[model samples]
Target: MSQHLLHTPLYDLHVNMGAKMVPFAGYEMPVQYALGVKKEHLHCRDAAGLFDVSHMGQLRLRGENAAKMLEMLVPVDVIDLPVGKQRYAFFTNEVGGIEDDLMVTNFGDHLFIVVNAACKTEDIAHLQAHLLADVELEVIEDRALLALQGPKAVEVLATLNPQVREMVFMDAARIELLGQECYVSRSGYTGEDGFEISVPNSHAVALATALIEDDNVEWIGLGARDSLRLECGLCLYGHDLDKTTTPVEASLLWGISKVRRTGGDRAGGFIGADVILTQMETKAVDRKRVGLMGQTKAPVREGSPLFDANNHQVGIVTSGTFGPSITMPVAMAYITTSCSQLDTVLFAEVRGKRLPMTVTKMPFVAQRYFRGE
Candidate 1:
């Protein structure tokens, strides 16, 4: 039996543009267009690329205890997150394992959150079940999300609304685009200067069309999206993160604010605070997420066994791809802490051959996020 796949508002436009479609997160989404993945990846790095990210889930949390309630689930300093600011965080489980990684924006009256498409359902259920007392979770089902990314992103988008240029990184505003109200944020996964716009589904086509017509903008697809994010060292929800992976092991300690840790005022109050705090204090994580740079053109894919000097298996690749921007194959993996140091030598077993790989710093491509002066 075929699974019933949902279609985003821009599905027809994608087909009309000669995009190759595939099933992703229960939705029929474009994997690549006629321009191909390599071209799309280069275009985004050189100019601007428009991506249909409507498959992502958007939700609003209301009530006076909205931030307080959310603090019980994640380690971010939500209570102090100023209005109009966005923070990257993860929804952690009771044992310090990650349930889902997400973005939380304090919208003054309500909190706006964006979760991974595949984890949206469970994320909402978790919130409702745990925060039933005072917080209300309202799914924003009537909006379509679009991401405009690259070096020329700011220039192209500023032409639509000059106010967009005024906004800094991680700052959001309720702006009007092509005569429609949109919640716009200056943030993205591709490590570029970009904006993620959430517009009403009714006017999604019009907005997308307007952006596509821009000279600097090209329609991008999932293939390039994956490559772009990989080069940027961003994690894919299902592959790089799961219930068994904790933030400490994932090297995402930056997401947990100092105020939320053991010595802070509101210490260790979240679901997995105990385990997470212990790992932080003792640095006792068995495995750590590290970047693998392949010396050859062959891309080392996920699940490939990583070996040490003695050819003993130490870990496995979690996400790997040909980084078009960097023009090489790069991968992310969790390996024994002993081998997680920079410049550590390792071998990836791909096919029947062993390939030499070096542990390198992530974000193979430099990020151009527009943080204000």
Candidate 2:
């Protein structure tokens, strides 16, 4: 491990809990606890798992026109993000490639944004250089984030603060926990009922301890985090998404609000909007992102090449792993339009052998998000 690797606020707590730490996104993060990745993955599926996601970047954009200013950078309905609601969006480049994917929440007074950990430095610089001068882009360095996810997450969180039980998926709120004010959102990367709490760094360890003490909750790490999200069919920034992949190519067109597309009121106003909107209207891309599953037990990994029966290269795997919950090898890849269709047969070249695979619908495991009634 590098001596200069950054540590999250809960680093010491992870160490104390017997976590195996590794370098991830420049931070020395826990890859798994004593229970291991497979167990941790199953635990989160059956009960609850707590993760220290403080390494992710949290930022605040404050100003009267903050939403309007942000509209210039990404293609989402930011201005119409009702207060206390959140939206998923992409930060696109001039050529329509994804710069980074993020979550934006309208806080009534300001826009609270969360970007990927590895892209935070560049994302901050991009925002500062592009946003209007009056729209102050503040890097929130004093906060720590924790994700409590699973079928039992609501029950565990409600015990600490009953108000949280009322928040549905994508709902954001300011809540009190152990007398500390924190921003709580009923949202997470894993396709499960959960909450991502942004709390002050000073109170992070205490909050983690309070949650982990619960019988239904256990310490989860990055290894399980990857498998869980992969099973849920979520993209990892540098892998499934990158500067060369456009939202349309990545199958994230649904993220582009109808009002921001070519014909709507706020259409084509954001960076790369012209290219992205054109792609959306015409479906111009040759390749599309799709889900894959191995027909056999052998696991296919990232960077593996995909080929047709005649041995012609057709695609490349972006993210791949054995899904503990699905009990199968699941992967995400970008393939030619012809091979991207569901149930299309393909072969993954692994270690000199071509293994049979099939294009399948994502979320190999069922999603269990808790959207309120």
Candidate 3:
């Protein structure tokens, strides 16, 4: 392990709980606890699992033109985003490729952004270079982000502060929980219902301890986090999504609001608008992202090539894992558009053998978001 690896606010708590620490994105993060990856993944599905996501970049963009300035970088309708609602967006390059994906929440006074850990440094610099001098960008360094996810997530969290019970999926708000004023969102990468809380660093350990003390909650780690997100068909940065892949090619066109597209009110102002919008109109992309499942128990992994019936390489796997929740080996890949259709048969080259894989609909399981009644 690198000696200069960074530690999260709950590092000592993870270590004392017998978590196996590993290096990721320059941080010594817990890969798994004594519960192991498979059990931890299942525990989250059945009960609740807490994650230390402090390594991710959290920033505040404050100014009257903040959202308008942010729209110049992402191909989403930022300016019109209603206050207290959160939206998913991705940064695009000049060539219509993804730079990084992020979440933007309209806080009335400012926009709160959360970016991927590995891309934070570059994302910060990108924002600094392009955003206006008046749009204040503040990197929040004194807070820790924690995600509490599962079927019982609401039940457990509501006990701490019943006000949270009113928040539905994608709702963002600032509330006082356990004596700490925290920024919280009823959202998570997992397909289950959950909440991501950003609390002051000084109170992080205390907050985590309070959550983990419940019999319904346990400490989860990165190893299980990957499997959980993969099973839900969520893309991981630098893997399923990258600078080489555009939102259209990655099946993320839905992320672009209709009003931002060619015929709508705020059309073609973002970076890569020409190419991405053309792709949207023509649908002539050579390759596309799709879901696949193996015929046997053998696990197919990333970088494995996919072949058609004629043995011609059509695509490559980007993210693969055995889904403990689904009890099957599933993966996502970039296959030729013609071969990316649902129910299309393909093969993944694992080791020296070509194993059969079928193109199936993503999110092998149902996404259970807690949308309020």
Expressed as tens digits, the lDDT of each residue in 54-113 for candidate 1 is 999999999988999999999989999999999999999988999999999887989999
Q: List the residue pairs that clash in candidate 3.
A: none
lDDT of 3: 0.94
Cα deviation of 7, candidate 1, in Å: 0.2
Candidate 2 Cα misplacement greater than 4 A, ranges: none
In angstroms, how far off is 112's CA in candidate 1? Answer: 0.5
TM-score, structure 1 vs. true: 0.98
* Per-candidate TM-score against the hidden true structure: 0.98, 0.99, 0.99
Q: How many steric overlaps are in each model, in order? A: 0, 0, 0
Give Cα distance to truth, residue 28, candidate 1, Å.
0.1
Which residue window of length 10 is worst by lDDT in model 3? Answer: 259-268
Model 3 lDDT tens row, 1-373: 7889999999999999999999999899999999999999999999999999999999999998898899999999899898999999999999999999999999999899999999999999999998887899999999999999999999999989998899999999998888999999999988999999999999999999999999999999999999999999899999999998999999999899888898876898899999999999999999999999889889899999999989999999999989899888999999999998889889999989999999999888788899977
Cα-lDDT of candidate 1: 0.92
